[model samples]
Target: MIHVAIIGQGLVALHFEVGLEKLKNNEIPDYGVPLRNWLPYKYDDIEIVASYDVDESKVGKTVYELAKRDYPGNHIPGSLKDIVVSRGIHLNSMKGLPFKARGREEDKGIEAAINELVDEWRSLNIDVLINIMTTEPVEPVGNAGEIERRALNGDLTASQTYAYAATLYSAKYRPVAFVNAIPSPIANDPGFIKLCSERRCVVFGDDGSTGATPFTADLLEHMYERNRKVIDIAQFNIGGNTDFLALNLPERNIMKKKTKSAIVEDILGYDAPNYIRPTGYLEPLGDKKFVAMIVEYYSFGEFKDEFYVVMRINDSPALAGLLVDLSRIGRIALDRQAYGSIYEVNAFYMKRPGPPGSKAVSKYHAFQGLLNWLGISDPRMQQARR
Candidate 1:
């Protein structure tokens, strides 16, 4: 059995736990679930052996406890009883984020907590580390002088905390793959990427899922195939959770905005009147996200053609299966002696993938590449394309 250890106890981690369970069962009964059915793999050989989270309410809890108590929004159709949660080192990564804690003493500084957690990771024999934590935007420390000053003072942020984790693991472990499930700079930063390459640990992603971009791209491709004249397109996103809150803060949204916008412009080869950014944060929506897209073009003489589409999905579960697949794939890469970033998996599975200004490839192609490299065929990938 392949032992997998997830790093964060957030929504993504819960989704992964569910997927791992399904894989263990060896049969996927269709539940008529919509977006949840899109995950492409179910491997009976995989198991989630351990998990870590700094939240006091979540620590020392079982997976079933986490599902029942912390994640009431999950609708996975079964009870989760066997999974267990262990205490995680609290890094500066959680600072300034809005979260609920059980005790007052738990809401203290992060440095010590993070150091202890790092030590635990070293000793636990974890196979893979999925960095599913929420990422904040890197603030401009003014100029080179200010950046140097902050670097000297060791001002800790989410980005720095992640880099530190990756660097530390690279030094002591047997090539642990780090999956950046959120839009954090650690995966994209040149220094961090170089560190992972040098240390031989694989790194993938700076973003997770695309709720509407894929469909929008398909529509644009169809129009192009029909010799239709495309004029403009606009996309809007709204949510009611931490992602929304992060988007509302300019400091946390710069990379996210750029990543989303690039997905359209790169595919279409031209800029549309793309209003692609988070519009508002609503309380009633919780972790649900609603995206509205409008595409307008001039086709026949004097005729204006417009296409409008709206998507509503639970953000966490939508990407959960994919993340689980990624973590498993990361382990596969390590077992096969693969190093650096796993580009094929990331390109096909991630939202804003690769360096900026690069074209997005189909997930089918990426999966095929991975299968060929690893010598494992996926039954789902062999089936007819959706």
Candidate 2:
């Protein structure tokens, strides 16, 4: 069983818990989940052992109560009824958020807070730590020593503090996989990657690729393979979630835009004139987000063609489904002694995968790489056809 700890007990975490309980009870709708369930373990094998959050409203509540509060009238399973939301590092993660952030700073500083988290996770036997925290505006640290210094001096972001805590926890206990589900640079940061490697922890992600970004990557790959000369592309998302609310800040928006736009150059081998970002937030839209895109390119005989795509998707659940894959992959990587970041898994599932300058492969190629890395012969793989 994979015992997991959550760093953010928000909608994504709630949806993830609901999905897990539903999967165990065979209550999942016939429509199917987005995850490729060909992993070594089933979704039910994952156990939510503990959770952390900085919101005062969410801090002391049990996971069940929080889920009910976030998604009122929704059914929360008994499996998650007992897990309480613990306090985590706040550190400007909730700066532009509606609620006032409450961190563990009153009782302890950064180092002590990390030590507290490590001890708690060690006692809880957390195998994986999934960070669904809000995106924080941060620049990558130069090295492990610098990050350690910053973390000790209370100079790191909330996500980085959580990562540092995960590393310390791993060093004291067995390997724990860390799946960073936001735009913060835990896995992509060279400093955190080095620390995770030294501590024998598996790290996955800079940002989870769920909706527009992955779709754009697939389409771009298709265009490149067909020898289409792409002229320009524009893609943006308008959402009503708290995440989008937070992204209204310029700094937070830049962190997200960086991840979304990184795929263009790596996939096409050159940068095209492109506009990709979270354009706005509409509270009335709720969790469903409006995604629109326009890709213009040249075909044979210098013919110009434009492709317009518009889609409305439930953003949180889509990403929450990916967390299932990431959590299990984390455990599998740990068991295999695949310390540090798993590029094969990250490339397929993340936006700006691997360290800061890693090239982005096509989704198909990434999937094949993941399957090969896991030694799983999926019949759908193009390599299998070969």
Candidate 3:
């Protein structure tokens, strides 16, 4: 079984905890999970061992309480009551945002806080640690040594510190995977990748590709395949989730902008003028978010064509489903001793697959690459061939 620990006990993490339990209990079908049931590991093999958060109100709450309070629909599993949201490393990730948050580092030292986290994971035997923290402004530290230094000094972001703690846990106990399901540059940071590789830990990250991001990616692939000269692209998302509130801050907003905009150049082999990022927050919308996009391109005979899309997606659960697959895949990576940031897994699930300076590919191609890496075939494709 893959024991999972969540770094940010937010909407996405809550959905994963509740939804995963239901999926294992056969109460729900795996709809949004891209590689569902195809990998060696099944939903039954996944478990939420622990969860962490820094919000003053959320620190000591059980997953069941959080879900019952925020999770839509009903039937939050009693199994979730077993896991409690503990205090996490803050590092001012929520600064400028309207939330009262504090980390153990505030009371203890950074070294102590990180050591404590490692101890908790060791006790829980966490195989995968998912970093789905609110978007924090951070840049890549290219040197692994620098990352280690900053981690000890509390100079790194919360996501980086958790990643460092995961590395420590891997080094002292067993190999593990740190699945970064946010926009922080853990996988994109070469230093973190090297650190994980040295410590025998795998990292899959940079940003979870859910809602409109993946759709726009595949759409770009369609245009590229048809040899359509894309003139420009504009896309935006407005949501009521805490993440959207966090992105309202300009610094946090830029992080999403960078991840969203990178796909254009990577997929088309040329840069296109584009505007893509979280545009606004509407509280009444709750977990469901409004997404809109416009892609203008040139066709034959110098004709200009345009594509417009508007959608409302349940953002958190969509990502939560992806986490189910990622949790199982994390165990598979450990079994294979595939340490460091894995590009194949990240390419399909992440907004910017990492190991620094890696080219982002279309989801269609990334899916094939993911399957190729696992040495497996899509069941539907297999049935069709038969």
Candidate 4:
């Protein structure tokens, strides 16, 4: 009966609620109550409870109300009728680095927002703060001290400070895990990583949303296994959410581009000249993600072949399953006193996984390892191992 609190109430948060519901209903004999259910395992059990968001429309709304208004996808099956949405400290959080917003004013004071949000979180006794916001590149390690000073001095906004304070608080608070579902620098920062180690709190991620790229990696790997020469690979993605909107700025995407490029390059063991960044964002598509990739290869002597793959997926639901798994795993890690990176779980669950110099493992292998670690024995994971 681990009580969970979600920090963001966007599409990703909605997906997490869906995953929590599935876990709740996954009943097992003598397990007392299912750990994964959306509702608390019991009435007043307070398992998956409360959500916090800064959106004016979402604040003070019930989870059910917010779900109906913003995410009509119904990613989470049941109506979250009882779950209440509380006002989260805004901390003036921004989605991507070199933050760019189409309409919003930039003068929203950050220090006030963050202080208020932190106060709210502390008051709520939140055990877990899942950051499912968009990707943002953290400053290089050397610049962290100056950034920290700026955040503390009210010179930085809530969004910027979140990366630093969240790391500090996570390390200071035992039994509380900070899970980053986005490709933000908080999870990768050396200071934060060390703090997590000291506090024995779990810090997971860099990116593991293998929606299209990982699938591409798998396809390329299979081709390479047959001695196929991959001459070029190009991936183009378009979406209409904050994740897509964040990429419009190059600064936010520096690490993301590096990470995605490396994943493909490592899989093929060759440099791909055809890689492309996420191109444009179309608002009509909302949270749906469309990825089109073209792979060109020369097989046999003087024979040229090309393969194109198009993947369209509901980004929220696609990642929902993984987040649910990660949240539950975070709880388990806390229970077992797991500390630092939680490599076994992180590698299987995150995108740019492992410590520097550690061999990169496939998503399938990581998923299998997670299932095994959780004693889930899910057939999918077992099949993945095979």
* The candidate that achieves the highest TM-score relative to the unseen native structure: 3
Model 4, 1-386: lDDT tens per residue?
55667766778787567545644565222121222343212322335576766566676777777777776654445547767876554433554433322212224455555555555556555566577655655553424466667766655433345545554555444356677666655555565566556666677766655577567656766776778888888888889887788777777766567656666666667676866567778988887888998988888895999988887877776666666556666666777777656666666656666443343455666656765666666655469999
Q: Is candidate 2 or candidate 4 better by TM-score?
A: 2
| Number of the top-ranking candidate, with lDDT as the measure | 3
Predictions in order: lDDT: 0.62, 0.86, 0.90, 0.62
Alpha-carbon shift of residue 310 in model 2 (angstroms): 0.3
For model 1, residues 307-339, the per-residue Cα lDDT tens digits are: 889889777776776665675677777776676
Query: Residue 72 CA error for candidate 4 (Å)?
Result: 1.7
In model 2, what are the clashing residue pairs, if there are any? none
Sort all candidates by lDDT, best to worst: 3, 2, 1, 4
TM-scores across all candidates? 0.78, 0.96, 0.98, 0.77
Measure candidate 4: CA RMSD: 5.6
Predicted candidate 2, C-alpha RMSD: 1.9
Which of 2 and 3 is the better model by lDDT?
3
- Residue 82's lDDT within candidate 1 is 60
**Model 2 segments beyond 4 Å from truth?**
29-36, 381-386
